[model samples]
Target: MNASLESTMRVKSSTEKDFLKLSGVNAVDVGYKYVDGKRTDEICIRVHVTKKKKTVYKKEMIPAEIDGIKTDVLEGTYVPQMLSPKAIDELLSDTVKYRPLKGGISIGPDRSVGGNIFTGTLGCMVTDVATGKPLMLSNYHVMCIDNGWHVGDQMNQPSLIDMGTHADGAGTLLRAVLSSHVDGAVASINSGINSSAAIVDIGNVAGTATALLGDAVRKRGRTTLLTYGFVDGLNGTVNIDYGDGIGVKTLTSQILIRPDTTINPRFSNSGDSGSTIVNGDDKVIGLLFAGSSSAPFLTIANPIGFVETELAVFIEAGLQPNLSKGGLENE
Candidate 1:
């Protein structure tokens, strides 16, 4: 971590709880702040208050500096809204078939009924470290029915959202790890189903790369198609709203992507969750999961290295040929 970021995080960790205890503070993080028209890194605290509530807390309740690091207090109404799936699978004709399965396509859990009605993106193809079998990767919320799924559940391509009814079954949930820093899961691709390790728009991912501040990256998702951005934050923490009763889950050590304003105003949007983030060389960097809804939208992702270690799988490179035992050839 850079000196500025390290100092900012130290302040965040030491004072986050104190900030949150205040009536209007909803979230806290480390980000850039404009000081004298120059961008300076600092600890950012989000204070959400209605026009009426703002009067209750005195200015002293929010500090302008903590531990000598500049503190930014952003005042806005912070409503905790639930996050819904963004991928809206285009309905295809019953006769229309997806010839080759690849990353950046629709997929979802196979329930007894209405399995294909909802869908998420297929992140990429990877090899299971234990079984050496080629498996498809995606968010647990996308493939596991948002934590209600079980092992051996059927998964389908072109998901139900794309009209992939029971007849279009494609794979089975192999393993899942949703209760951690990442919302990830994998499924075993079924026999005779063709799949490619390459991502859409972006070509084959040669390998994995460590995320660095200011690195250029891009991803192809089911919703927004292909978009590019730059890594703006590291070792970051975020709170994600999983709905009313589910509340929020705190994710740590996350990579934050800000849209390249010079190119596009946005990076990823709804339904783009589970897309793989890769660098200019097409090397994997992170797995995209969430984004901010407001302007200067930011995309959040789990570092690819962390995801691989947590899931015990290796993202496959190039095209993967069908193996009788369902294993990738090079592995």
Candidate 2:
């Protein structure tokens, strides 16, 4: 059901205090828009906790705001603290939060989070433009992360959404699951759009996650969630300006995300490229394709609009990705 987007289903008629009591769960029921302008029921999966954790570092509740809406922001500065369901409750104040995978409370006993962690947008959709076919895109890479992104590899993406009580927005919800791979999940999700990818030159990637210049976007990575920022003009386009000492190739994006919007912990980290990128109102905006980890390490994203058409074409082709052998997909 709508479990990936933990916000899709929440305790009904919840108050700030109610959400404050938030802790992770396996499954629950939360409704979205109703038929007669009433509340309807929907399935929601609580953020899962892993068991590999050995200790809890830091766990403290902090007060913060959600898009001008006052709320509490809980922090887990250490490994074990990251997966605290109660802590997650405080952070997900009517919003989705991607907890770290290392936290044992969220992992399946049979599964492992070591090789690479996993976290994806859980409330968005993709479609083909030409044939109007529908697909759910994440990233070709997420399917198989052995050395290069491949087809037939398993991955995760958002399906249902509940935007929650916002000004001039509707709450949405859906259900979905993640396997090793999907045939055409990329084309289906991207719908031939590149809104969520960016430039990648090494460490197992090609092309860039696409995004629009000056577009508002959110990234759900393995180590963090809701990392908000905007797209800039640091692309591969070649241009020579005889005006001054303006040399190109200096890919740059110093765009600042509102501190309130930034995920205290980045949802995804080094091995989290195919993670979902969303926009306001909980729509798929882009995918977290690339970034750096140095002083002022800038991040880069891909624009979905660029390849939306191409994705549409693939969606029409009807490729069913199966991660049969995509180079040890975290096995």
lDDT of 2 by residue, 3-33 (tens): 3223321222232233323342111112122
TM-score of 1: 0.81
What TM-score does structure 2 among the candidates reach?
0.34
TM-score of each prediction: 0.81, 0.34
Question: What lDDT does the true structure give each of the candidates?
Answer: 0.68, 0.28
Relative to the unseen true structure, what is the C-alpha lDDT of residue 258 in candidate 1, on a scale of 0 to 100? 82
Clashing pairs in 1: 86-271, 87-271, 116-160, 116-161
**Error of model 1, residue 325, in angstroms:** 11
214-327 per-residue lDDT for model 1 (tens digits): 789998777667788988666655556665344667677777778887787778666667888998878899988877666556787888888898889997666554434433
- Residue 81, candidate 2: Cα error in Å is 22
Q: What stretches of model 2 exceed 4 Å from their correct place?
A: 1-123, 129-133, 146-216, 236-268, 276-285, 313-331
User: With candidate 2 superimposed using the best TM-score fit, by how many Å does residue 236's alpha carbon deviate from the native?
Assistant: 5.1
Tell me, what's the RMSD of every candidate?
A: 5.0, 20.7
